[model samples]
Target chain A: MSDHAKVIKKHHDHHAHAIAKPGKRLMHHVPLAFVLKKVLGHGGRNVNTALNLTSYIDFLLVTVIFLLMSFSAGGEITVDKSITLPNAENVEDVIEAPMVAVNGQSVMVDGTPAGNTRAIRDAGKVQKVDELFELLKRKKELWSSFHPDKAFPGVAILQVDVDVEALVVKSVFQTAAFAGYPNISFMVRKRAKAGGGEGG
Target chain B: MGGVDVGGGGGGKRAVNAEINMIPFIDLLMVTIAFLLITAVWVTNSRMNANAQVPGPPNTEPTEVTTPEKILHLHIEEFEFKLVWQQGSTVVAEDKVPKQEQTDKEFVKFGDLAVKIAEQWQQHGGHQDPSDQKTDQCVVHADNKLPFRELVGVLDAIYDKKREQNQADGTIKNVPVFNMSFSIR
Candidate 1:
């Protein structure tokens, strides 16, 4: 054989030696400790680091999804008026439109009078219960007219004063219910202050 | 024991490995924040009524302005409904719906008041001139302590009655929200 042919034969032998026998390969399992030591450094510290990374990624993913859900609400319907709303201990966040103050005597729609001249204090004069129906009916009509495609706003915020009796507040809800507006939300401050320290 | 050299493998070597790749986490957080902000903004803008047209100037001399009618302001004290109006205000009409004196329920007399207001609103002269119909806006000045329910009931009654009227007549009646202002006492 020529020198080049001899060199080629040696190279072919080396390549053949590199390929393992088919049946032996199945039995050639790396030791668990060997694999662990190689991948996770000497004392399993690297394994913990990798596990922490995986868990951290999971935590971040979950947090992202949670936050996305929290921040996606549209412009909040707000009622910026003088009427102070009664606070509740079991308060929940509710979406609403401009508030219509009902002090049990007079009705104010968006802080404007939409009813009779009934003083709140005078028990026999103004029929507030009857007036609420009128106000809700008007609001419903206005909303329907403006948003004729059934896009009328749903909830009405009632900023009933803290001193207003529960019966009066309940009447407001009843009026809203009758007016076909089922969602009536009581307005409240973030941090309770004033006379209503808790459970007003 | 399978005669494998397990004991000879270096198990005593210690190494510290606490470093973490925070790049992916930071990237994910940024993406999430951006997504939430965009969704919130989109939702907010979708609610804005962009098609609402501004009211233009009155076409000609207003009709209700010429009559100078006086509006009767009613006050609901603890027990009575009192009527109030300025001296020069034109007294269109004033009548009260008598209620059961013993009733403790704070129900607003919306239906009767609505009928009265509807009649008053209809009575305002719009038949004389076609141009004066849109300009007649009722100005209501209310006491501060009025119940929110009662007030809404009044507005609701006015709206319901008028809509009922329009539905009955089969003519589209656009009832303007009578301009209502408050005297916060």
Candidate 2:
């Protein structure tokens, strides 16, 4: 062939493969090359997908709004999974306080096991719970020391189980009162209302 | 130039549409979602407060008996609730509402103690006459063995009390009744 024709043919060959470079190819030396080859039909075409982000962006927006609405910045409390808190309609805003959790069979102060509920109940009379009392007293002292400027807000949260006896509640409550934390907040679940506010 | 027009501002005509890079926007949104999802707390916890009714410390040196003013008291028993109104040392009024056990009903209702309490309040001219604020508050004496759920039910019944409020603007408003507290003997 003539030199001019040969040069033109070489340039055309290079231009024919303009979509890809000379050696680089997709799935080159890929793991499970046989499986990939079998999955992709012999069309000799590179799979190019146009990501439809509209729906994804919409999902993200809804999620973000939901999070924003339900966001709690206090980080002051966590739900005790051991006990099921009673549901109530008349509720006030939650306050940050040391929680004294009492269950059907146990008593815990700030997640630490303190006393037994069954023994106290078996005794069958009004009495003071010593372990709970001491823990609360120490908690009160700590609260007093840390925020010296503010008045010791003598507030305590009682995370008691719904099935627990009032006697157990009374003992723990009495102990807390004796500890000088008089203002008590009974932790409860917000009762769900019917006929509305349920966003399906 | 980028969206819909598809020209990407490559030609002589000035691009009417601004090409906004959505990659960064999506990246930012993803990060925000991750942060929120990681930190989101699902427990819708709430509180029912029993403010400052500390039954006196263990045992103390004998002191002078303090005169308390008018107050509402609900002593929760196993099968009944003793509703009493007291002033100083004397009880102004007292009533009983027997609790009903759950039969076909899903929950144990305290059986309309609101009407009884209202009647008692009207007859006694009930209000907070703050001689000693501590004593003037409504005290709930729930028995040790009584389940906490019943106590909550009693609270729910009484919490429905609404007092008619006369505003300066010539409008009437309804306000909640006396706030309740707890007491242990």
Candidate 3:
């Protein structure tokens, strides 16, 4: 073969070989020494990939702060489901004390069942409820024992249903007074504004 | 651009492992939101206290008896509220306020009654006594058949303070006029 023809044939063969193996062409683009260094630098261990938790933690912290601010730290009285309180615009925060709940058919003192309201009313003119008096007296004694130096504050909280008659409420009040609770407070739902307000 | 090729160039740089596990994060947020919602409801239902001092037994008697001070009494009935002003044992003035008629709901009207009480307070020289810094005291006697709401309305009427707004400066001031207590008749 002539010298020029042989040189062209050799060039074509090299081009065909390069096209057949694309990986070899890519390897030529990157240094083999650099690739070996990267592979060996990792020590053949898989790198850990995980979700970034910083944002989630920040959100949780914000929520916790909001909850703490909203929490009512003052001793909150648990109201019975049976009693519905009257709404008042001007009232103060309640202090910690024993609660006396007077519902439609029953009365409970500190969540303990005192007596049935209807039975007490029907039991021939009850000026003072015996069961409630006993319970309150017991509570007072217990409190007195705990605070030997201080006198009983005689403070009691009354949770009476708005639908209950005034007479029944009066009896409960008198009974609490006779049991050494002279300073009574009524638990009321707070109204937002002054006159013509709705219950909270 | 000159970095080592980790894999054969069949595809471009292998897609990065960008998938973030979201199950736990979503669960945490859901729980926090639920807790906040529950506490918000509870905060709205917090209780407010209204105090009443029960009349105790007579502790002591004055050695020298003098004329007793005048007292204002409020009598609450099912259909009406009666106002009685007394000095010692004599009744000085009396008035009655009837319930307003309503078909849809029960509403107690006390604006007129409040004006009358204010007038009586003025006539009695209640604001004149410097020693009496506090408002006049009122005793409320509610009927047995009366509902608690009605009684509260009567008390509120007697004890509600008036707010006077200053036009010159945007400020309001409370004019405390009465202090009240309740009793069952």
Candidate 4:
């Protein structure tokens, strides 16, 4: 609808008062008139009007597809906007576990800042990430308490940026490993197509 | 395209029977398509389970390490990947592969690395067919300059299911990644 039409329609909020009396006959003959009034807007703007339904449908379809693709994607693991994960073809289903996200500057454990990536880099040596290790250790202990009979499943997801340094990755991995988590999952974006690429 | 009379007329006037009401059908079809596409996102883009054993910190009691002989160590440099194969107390083999860009034709740099990894696996006490063994861990020591994308590309190629094509009978094999862990300084 044009902006002028929208403005006029807003003023005619009570379109059901008098002019819509004739619309009842149109509605009885064509149920689609009611549908169009509900979906498109009110005031019964020419029930017999021919519209380019193809383009309207195309627009709705495209909007729906984009919304569906990204809406609530992997609720357990939020697709971090800051980190660009590497694309990989061989991936398994996501396991619900403590996730450690390492971007360019900092390391966040389950969305909480656990350690400083810059500090680790400046250290110039492979040092234990004490903050991350303690968080993971607490998590492990909590899990063990919950399941007294079963062993604590030590699974963690490493959602690191593709451009992150290897030293930072290694530090996080070692911290998680030492904190009693052994089974690690690398969070990777599924490749759009399988081809003869670097697996790149 | 059957339609009903427009004004409830029965005096032999022309009925609105010539029009096909395709708008409602199109609306229904598009709504269904939109619904299915949105729900399927939850099931896609999962994790790569690397049941890996990373080399841990000092001053802590160490866990059981993989046998020295069976370790396949890959050291990543800016442009070179140094691969060392250690079997039993001695280093069995050593090789280096240059990094190739994604646009490299016929063979990218990772393709060569995948082939070398297979050859090493076959020679280093693998089954008569390299495809038979689906359990092998690779320890990668990467430099600070190397991007994680390059590392993962190599890792994906190493464990690719099709990497076992050098078999005699020509049957495809499962992936050959028992665990893939990174090493520290």
- Clash tally for model 2: 2
Best by TM-score: 2
Order by DockQ, highest first: 2, 4, 3, 1
What is candidate 2's TM-score against the reference? 0.68
> Where does candidate 3 stray beyond 4 Å?
A1-71, A123-126, A194-200, B1-66, B101-135, B162-179
lDDT of 3 by residue, B1-185 (tens): 11233444435666544445567766777787787666563633333323345666686866677776667887766667688888877998887777542211333336555556666666662443433344566777876766776665555455454433243355544444555655644
Model 3: how far is A40 from its true place, Å? Answer: 39
Q: How are the candidates ranked when ordered by lDDT, highest leading?
A: 2, 4, 3, 1
| lDDT per residue as tens, model 4, B37-57 | 646555355676665463444
Off by over 4 Å in 2: A1-56, A193-200, B1-18, B55-68, B98-111, B114-136, B160-176, B183-185
User: Any runs in candidate 4 off by more than 4 Å, and if so which?
Assistant: A1-76, A192-200, B1-31, B37-44, B52-69, B103-109, B125-134, B161-173
Runs of candidate 1 with Cα error greater than 4 angstroms are: A1-59, A69-75, A79-98, A102-107, A111-118, A123-126, A129-137, A144-157, A166-200, B1-25, B34-185
| Candidate structures ordered by TM-score, highest first | 2, 4, 3, 1
Using DockQ as the measure, the top candidate is: 2
Model 4 Cα lDDT, one tens digit per residue, A66-165: 6765676545457678988787666666778898999998898878889998998898777789999999999999898888899777899999898787
| Cα displacement (Å) at residue A106, model 4 | 1.2
User: What DockQ, on C-alphas, does every prediction get?
Assistant: 0.05, 0.38, 0.22, 0.32
Pairs of colliding residues, candidate 3? none
lDDT of 1: 0.46
Displacement of residue A196 (Cα, Å) in model 4 is 7.9
Tens digits of lDDT, candidate 1, A1-200: 99999878988785457665553233235667676555555554434332335565677778777776667454554444444543222233445465667553566677677543233244432233566677778878887888877765456666665445434544455556566665555554332222452210
Question: Clashes per prediction?
Answer: 54, 2, 0, 2
